[model samples]
Target chain A: MVENHPSQASKFKCEVKNLNFYYGSVRVLKDINLSVFSHQVTALIGPSGCGKTTLLRCFNRMHDLYPGNRYTGEIELDKINILAPWIDPIEVRMRIGMVFQKPNPFPKSIYENVAYGLRVRGQSQRSAIDETVEQALRNAALWDEVKDRLYDLAFNLSGGQQQRLCIARALATNPEMILFDEPTSALDPIATASIEELITQLKEKVTILIVTHSMQQAARISDRTAFMYLGEIIEFDRTQTIFSDPTHRKTQDYVNGRFG
Target chain B: MTIDNLHQLHRLIARNRFWEKIFIVFGILSLLVGIITLLALLIDMTIDGLPRLSWQFFTSFPSRKYEEAGILSAWVGTCLVILVTAIAAIPIGIASGIYLEEYAKKNWLGDIIEINVTNLAGIPSIIYGLLALGLFVEQLKLGRSILTAGLTLSLLVLPIVIVTTREAIRAIPNSIREAACALGASKWQTIWDHILPYSIGSILTGIIIGLARAVGETAPLITIGALTFIAFLPDSPFKSEFPYISFNWLQAEFTVMPIQMFNWVSRPDPEFQSNAAAAGVVLVFMTLAMNAIAIFIRYRLRRRIKW
Candidate 1:
């Protein structure tokens, strides 16, 4: 833990080593190595079935939620093996909260959705839950739009508001890293732009890993970007360098919309 | 044919409003038929059995004479059987459902249990009675006591409780469980704190329906030899004298409402027939009360856990 911080040369606040994953002998992701940095947003751009989400799910161990989806490598958060058999997936998830591809607000009031994590973690007092819910929603940039009708059911919110509530739910537990699995994929363009702006603003205090298919979104919001192709990341560099002068031809071709 | 068809069209066109009025009258007549059928059943039951609906009918003991036999013992026996049966069935049935839905692995054992549970729900009630006779009465020596009858009834309703409970548990989405687990809650905590509460409304609805089915069962109680005109009040679920009870579960016999109705219906006396209908009315009211309790709990739980 002591060796994790204060290393300028270290590109990753969290790192994956020799990562490989399989779903019942059908390989979904092949050897992957990447380092996510603190205080910066890193975007992963790849077409569908390119294993972008599979690799992002590695961080929070969401794949383990399903039996028979096996991994054979190490995902380290502060030098601890995340994929270790003894590591508690629930604890890992709390540390690395996820915003799913779809806006899945719980079938509950918006206020409870925001306060869900705290309440589930055994915090029962109204004042603390209320305070945390307010703070999390504020952090997700959704408090103003929903403060008046927090007690109203979450389904009453429009698509964009629901997406923000999902983000707020993830933020409620004060996670160290936030993994977004194509969070804007289901939203309209206006909502997508708003989410992109929120991600940019969020990088100062959180390590953000966004798996997106949009090359423009990667260039606009990410400090660094990784291009994954066929279960392997082909390139990783500073966002502009990878977009403008990518060393790998496949990365260059894909970014230029030549082919998937 | 041409002249008749043209004349009919002319009449229909001239009396369109009259045809609409005729159709409306027929529609209302069909609805009234349904209401009248139910009303007739109630009124017939009331007219035949209302004379026996007195304090003596409840308090007096059975007699060899036509006018002397009271439902006191059979009533308490039936109540004892039903209460014990529900106590035995609800927890076991509900817990089994939760286990199958949440914890069971996708394997041959789970598949077999699921299939067996559905088939159990379809078995004839008399078959359950025989099984109870062979197992509870003969092998265990529970005798023709109320406990034996209660056990038989519990088995009768177990499958239904399980099936309904499985449906209720399935109605809850996986997202709620995931959300709870993601909050660093234990497996048990997630179930107790989220899954169970989320499913309580539906589970209670299923149990009430199951209890209604339990209360109406007659053949099984008869197989266990429900006392036809028992008149002594049950001592308790604990007492061992005439109202057999024991602190240890080794000694307890009980009675229930359906058993009393069966006892009254089986006698040859005219008074006993009226008494049977009277007991039927009470049984109907009890089942109705259970159904209402279920609906009330479902509505209350829904309001409390709208999430």
Candidate 2:
């Protein structure tokens, strides 16, 4: 069992309070409260349609891209309510990056894929962009494979390399946090292991909020785990506690492979 | 479980296979019917017209003497008009497409506009010419010149461009937009940097196809008062003086390939029929070339893009 540290409360990077999400007229997420610690991975594990992905998207206001989706709640990042009406979702997104389940590299060169976010932030200097692209690629552990052919089309990369390229893309902007929505769901087992290892290493630099369907994946990478059932967090505790000694019967049943 | 039952099921499978074979044969026959008709017409046109194709046939102006007549004025007019059509239609069509697909709210008004845009493509080409006659020629006083004809064709093909642009843009997956937006890019940034670049190849294919259709059009140009016989070319768009460019050619009188062909075919001279056939060959080649270019571009661009 991982011991509870006294300074854990001070490391709170994000706090979600009484969050409710709606897709048009349908209420998708119920009142939910959760806390994410700085420089730590917090995994949300739930069955399909349990609102895990929706809650993760709320952190960056991704629902704003589509029409009729709505959110009512406070998602505070660094004590700032990112969900405030006046706060531009674009601004919020800039500070918090996201990697999707599928490896969706742009139809562009590998270098351009990594450089896109920096370019979006108006970083026009060629040297600065080059440096950041290299650093981000190295950080994602994809530099060695693609460094020699950075100008090749990103689609040429293998599935694993493409997912890592996506990770590198998300990391280029130096975002405060990164969201992973089943980032390895589409990858093979070997690729999934590499991605899981990379995510564990990534928590040393940026806070992570991952929504995973695989309970084993959550236990493997996350320091803290939140078991969500029916749009609500059923249990929030250390990964060790959630798997070995969960207070909620739902969490126990889910982690034991009995039910989801 | 009985042998009699097995025999009946075998017969059913055999019947389905027979229908499948019949469908394959019918599909090939239908395809060949269209191909053979086009090939026969092309062969006949070439047999009559290929002998007449020469440097002189391309460079000389129209004349009463069919042997001396060439398509210089007609071809030049067609080129300039197409240039104008491309310029006027491309930006407007693509912008409208982007606005409708990306920016417009999904509502009753948007739905109505979508249906109207689609219906516009089905409208007769003559209607566009008449509308242009009233709007551009009379109300705007643009005169029966290349500018007027080009604008008329632009309006005629605008729906084609818009529809195609929308289709190309729609083919880009939703994940691409999400990826761009997730990177904190503004809506315009996403479109300009990613959406436009990805969809440009398909959009260009649509534009060339529209232009090819515009090239073969006759009724619209005729209604717009395009001349059938012309002895001189429009003034050069390039100049020797400062600024070195001119718009005078836009306002000059013009004739197109179809108009010239029509005039020859209607003439009482047997020799003029060969000239018309020659013009028909060139027109068909131009359309075919444009389509080939579109196909080539689509092939090249699509090779690098995968979902």
Candidate 3:
């Protein structure tokens, strides 16, 4: 479906070179060498605990929260060493925003929720924050549902709406890359379609990296797909090619639902 | 006898049942005694103390001849002291709770602090008084004064305040903290802006309960050496021998309700015994009122916090 998209021919923007990760004594991700093109939705698909979530977290170093979690080698964003000791994990996270599996909104009003990131980095003016919150919400396709109720507590919103609000909460910071970890896993079909459409739309402006278990969803939304098995990537290629004629037998088998 | 011999093995089981029922009855009867004793004590105090309760108890000063005097000064002193102690404990306790829960790293130092705080909460009140005597009185030279006694009580109740407050903070889900964190707020900013407001209702409830204990404390204040009789209030904590200035924050040699009640009970006058009962009633009401307020707030918070 990507069909001659000019940007698809571009070389790697984010290179993962012999990147390895571990938690305590167990390795969650083997040496993974791949490249994610800029402004493309490269979906990582695997069985549960196949290191899909772990690899997604590696993009922003969010895995640091887990005890004894460690990463080796390089995940380069624009050829800069993101995994090296010199980088601040917080700053890397700032550049790479994230949304969790569950919508975790603060016990705050919608406006406050979106403006919170800005406020923390020390933005005080009312007009500036208001404009940014509005812009972020509009970008996430949540402004139409929540514009009139911006002052209401975010928990009052429906689950799908809350997830969008969380997306807006992340986008308010204006990060270059956004990570979605099963972003639509908790939503119904209608909401899932809306989020899928939103992510496809979002890919035009912000580079996206998503982890999902749904094979149909991976084919439907992503431009490129990576099949991972037991912490190792079995294949990575154009989505259409991978689905139709996968190079690796395991990759073809996984896409055909013959095996996971 | 041959037919009954096969059934003889179950006889001991029936005997065991009899003793089990007896022990169960004994446990029930033991609990009954405590409940009845409490009810009797309440009834006796109400009957004996009701007659002596009047404006006289709230107006006159204590006298050496107990028949002519009242506990107005002691009552006023206890109120003033507890108020000050609460004012000091609430903020420090809540801040420490928030810090321990939200910011403290999971490390040996944090574990050490947690263990020390738990141990401090279990220590006897008299030990707190001794600690105060050593620190505030001898080392700092605050003197054997009302301020010193009130501080001793504060220190005695502080550990409970901290422990309860930390529990209240912990009851909040980690998802909430993560939400705030994902907002790009720094750790302290997230705690200050979002987490603290949600946890305040429970923190205040713990504080009110702490205040109740602080107000009812008699041993620590006695250990800090409060006077049973002071005709006039002192201006400053250092001015124990002064022509009474009646200041609120600083106090020198003042009697609280329990100290006064103990002094009155030890008196030979049948009249003083009745007054002690009245004082006991006042003490119980103060604690009960505070406890009721805390419970009311807790209920309202439970209903109000939708998430």
Candidate 4:
């Protein structure tokens, strides 16, 4: 394990060390190192194109969708090297679920959308699938709104409900960590508040690494905040210290809105 | 000076709007011209063939007597040929399309395949007929039978099926694929469970349109030596005995509607000309029916999946 500072605990759900990433010939992330504490919300606050999304995608190897994207160094989840050559990307994804910025539910029924991950994990029993689907929807705070219309097409739901359904889909697999990529940026103020509440509740069950553009959101929900600029983390500290009195000049300027 | 400049800009905008209106008129004229030609042809076919459109004209087999001749054998042959073409082309075309769109990497091999498929789609149907004649008829020794004609038609339409299937698969958003992948679904499972279901309507539309084109094609079937005059039916697929379905039907000689119409149109008799026009009408109706079914299904699917 990497050495932790005396003030921080040593219990990390996942750890990244000397991580470097490139898309074709252009380096996007350079020599990144960070640790996600267990069952806590760690928010990555950065400007656009600062490699926050790239880092989240790297956690599940979502960059494998296309060719010419490369990664180096190590990302260990619970002491197991997730980036090891022998590890299957599909298996890694099951352990680390992701909710995208835009809510994308399949064009299937609401019940099918929640049950999809379970079905993919090879759960075939109808009774078990039904029970798990209900549990996931309840956890996502969507069961009461959608229980009567479980068979309706997912697109029939409102924007917030659809986002919640996407969360339910991600929750169905019961991953160790769930990554949220600007999950509330597309939502309205009310919807954003509800989703923020959901995130805080969710942190009790799974480690969350949320990338947000909103500094207020970071202050409100994140236990720890990492301020990133260019392609590097400028400061990693408690949310209170990062907001009230940062250690770095860059973090202080960013917190005071001097510049991105 | 500022007012003069604003006046000049207004004049330029007015001139552009005038030209746009002229182009719109030209486009409407061009569309009307095409639609008018089609309408004229349909009217002529109705006039020539409506009298011959009776129960007997559909039920009776072809004969030396023009009055006694019907499209039973030819229509049945067309249906059989289409069945074979669909069976041979649908799976192969959809699979190749999926591979090219979803699985294949952006490398030299993939580029070569894409370019070759585009080139294949441009080649004439008669060229495909010659290739099938050389390969299936002579080299494979399938002879000029029903199987040979069906296989030839399948080759003629394969490029269309593949091209349209690829287009349909490409229309699917990448988000759906990524969502499936993130849920721990394997590549094959993601494609089978999500991709195929979402795009099945378009794929079937492509297949039907391709089959419709194959049904109307004459040169390929004629070039492959399908008979124009056949009195007896092919062996029956069903029987009263055990193992009831028979494969012997495939080996029998067959005649399609186009070839039969071509034979009649080439004859000197006026009655034969009427018979040819009637057969043309039947072919047109069949093509229309297939297209209608495809359109209906595509419309329903579009409604069902709004996203």
Best-performing candidate as measured by TM-score = 2
Docking class of 4: medium
**TM-score for model 3?**
0.87
Write one digit per residue (lDDT tens) for candidate 2, span B1-307.
8999999999999999999999999999999999999999989888888888999999999989989999999999899999999999999999999999999999999999999999999999999999998998999999999999999999988999999989999999999999999999999999999889999999999999999999989898888888888889999999999789999999999999999999999999888888889999999999999999999999998888889
Cα deviation in Å at residue A171, candidate 4? Answer: 0.9
- Top model by lDDT, which number? 2
Model 4 agreement with the true structure over A1-260: per-residue lDDT tens digits: 11323443447988998888899988898888999888889999988889998988999989987889888889989888888878999989999999999889999999999999998988999999999999899999999999999999999998888999999999988998999999998889998888999998888778899999999999999988998887788889889999999999989998888886
For candidate 2 chain B, the 10 contiguous residues with the lowest summed lDDT are: B220-229
Q: Which window of ten consecutive residues has the lowest lDDT sum in model 1 chain A? A: A1-10
Better of 1 and 2 by TM-score: 2
Each model's TM-score for chain A is: 0.95, 0.96, 0.95, 0.95
Candidates sorted on TM-score, descending: 2, 4, 3, 1
Model 1 spans > 4 angstroms off: A1-10, A108-111, A119-130, A145-156, A247-253, A257-260, B1-47, B54-76, B134-147, B236-254, B299-307
Clashes of each: 15, 0, 0, 0
Cα RMSD for predicted model 1: 5.8
RMSD to the true structure for each prediction, in A, is 5.8, 2.4, 4.8, 3.2
| Model 3 misplacement above 4 A | A1-13, B1-34, B65-68, B103-105, B234-248
Best by DockQ: 2
Q: In model 3, how large is the Cα lDDT of residue B33?
A: 100
- Per-model chain B TM-scores are 0.82, 0.94, 0.85, 0.92
- Place model 2 in a CAPRI quality band: high
